[model samples]
Target: MTTTTRTAVVTGAARGIGAGVAKRLAADGFAVAVIDLDEAACKPVAEEIEATGGRALAVGVDVADEQGVQAAVDRIAKELGEPTVLVNNAGIIRDNLMFKMTADDWDAVMNVHLRGSFLMTRAVQGYMTKAGWGRIVSLSSTSALGNRGQANYAAAKAGLQGFTKTLAFELGKFGVTANAIAPGFIETEMTAATAERVGMPFEEFKKAAASQIPVARTGRPADIAHAVSFFVSEGAGFVSGQVLYVAGGPKA
Candidate 1:
């Protein structure tokens, strides 16, 4: 199958890294499903893709809800075609020290990051299996390596790495590849929130972060998107269960 003609489903695609990934995938020629918690939130991204001569369907879905995820996947298959490419990019952060963290905060992050990926993968696996080929990319984070005030977020992100490896092993024989991208210091709304939480100017925060990175630069969402594109390419069939840290340098 031609790469440009394939269908892809990207969760949390309304903005930030998810939006970047969705746009990049569309540029690669896939008919994309722009899925976010609020369907209306996805319109601008979807419309942008369409305006550029790409096919996209805006789907409202709460990836944490099994039923919602199933329905969204079904809709994509019906409207866009069977999705062989799936990006589990939906996530949220509930940052707090372990002692002060609430159960709700922990559950919310786990539900959206880990559970959501699980549900979305399950819903789309059928289409991938039927086609005998697929690409599954989940967003992990440098926080997985361990970060202060991010116990819940760190655990959930780390879990995705394990989940991705298992999928690669289980689905490799079917011409499917599963991988994770652990991004570091990417410029996104999430990071902006982190800066706000810490009472730092966003620009100053990014600059401080860049000073520590070996590349002397903070990452862009597009940088992470490029990594995802590589993993999902037709030529990447033999590469599976790998976690590429797109953090501009080796982890400290």
Candidate 2:
């Protein structure tokens, strides 16, 4: 995006891909709100941005809580500025075979991925609509297509695609565009946890995953961050209701 005084909020931004996206937006000249479940967790990223001459605020709030979400967004508006750009990147994985999945696992995934996105979007869209311009990018996953042992995650990611498309339809008239970035095999703490769960060293797991990727390597936080940068750029105004797969290959 061209340098603007606009403010952007990136949820789950304490680390990994969300942190990368938050920093990138700050570099792109938007005052950024780095939000996570823990405000302290967000300080490093927000402080780094400010140290680099960018405006940033670290806010703590649960995206899945309605009142908390509203209160957080309101605080952002007052402390930062009208947030017209949003990245819904907060998520959790409760991977399990269908027969082994618990209702709690499913609910937890749905509440954070689906409900969180909905509430965050709802809280931010008013500013977007009133401003007559906005960009929203939600994190989806290749799992959405179907993933073994990730029924809960796959369903939530797939649901977000539908959610993103609907937002495009409903908000297009107001000059707001919505899109999703479905990443595949990005190296992060979450993936390391997966490796541990499966009894493999994280490095070996990445090597095995890389062998199958056309790019000859796994994706990284920067890869997804670059994709988000594109979707929210001023030049991307015409793109909406789209899912861009940044999986280092045409298919994931």
The CA root-mean-square deviation of candidate 2, after full C-alpha superposition on the true structure, stands at 1.1
lDDT of each: 0.94, 0.96
> TM-scores of all models?
0.98, 0.98
Encode model 2's per-residue lDDT on 157-224: one tens digit a residue: 99999999999999999999999999999999999999999999999999999999999999999999
Q: Once superposed on the true structure, which residue ranges of model 2 sit more than 4 Å away at CA?
A: 1-4
**Pairs of residues at least 3 apart in sequence or in different chains that clash in candidate 2:** none
lDDT for 59 in candidate 2 is 98
Q: Please report how far candidate 2 places residue 78 from its true position, in Å.
A: 0.2
Span of ten consecutive residues with least summed lDDT in model 1:
1-10
Candidate 1 has what TM-score?
0.98
Off by over 4 Å in 1: 1-4
Model 1 gets an lDDT of 0.94
lDDT of 2: 0.96
Shift of residue 233 alpha carbon in model 1, Å: 0.5
Residue 27 shift from truth in candidate 1, angstroms: 0.5
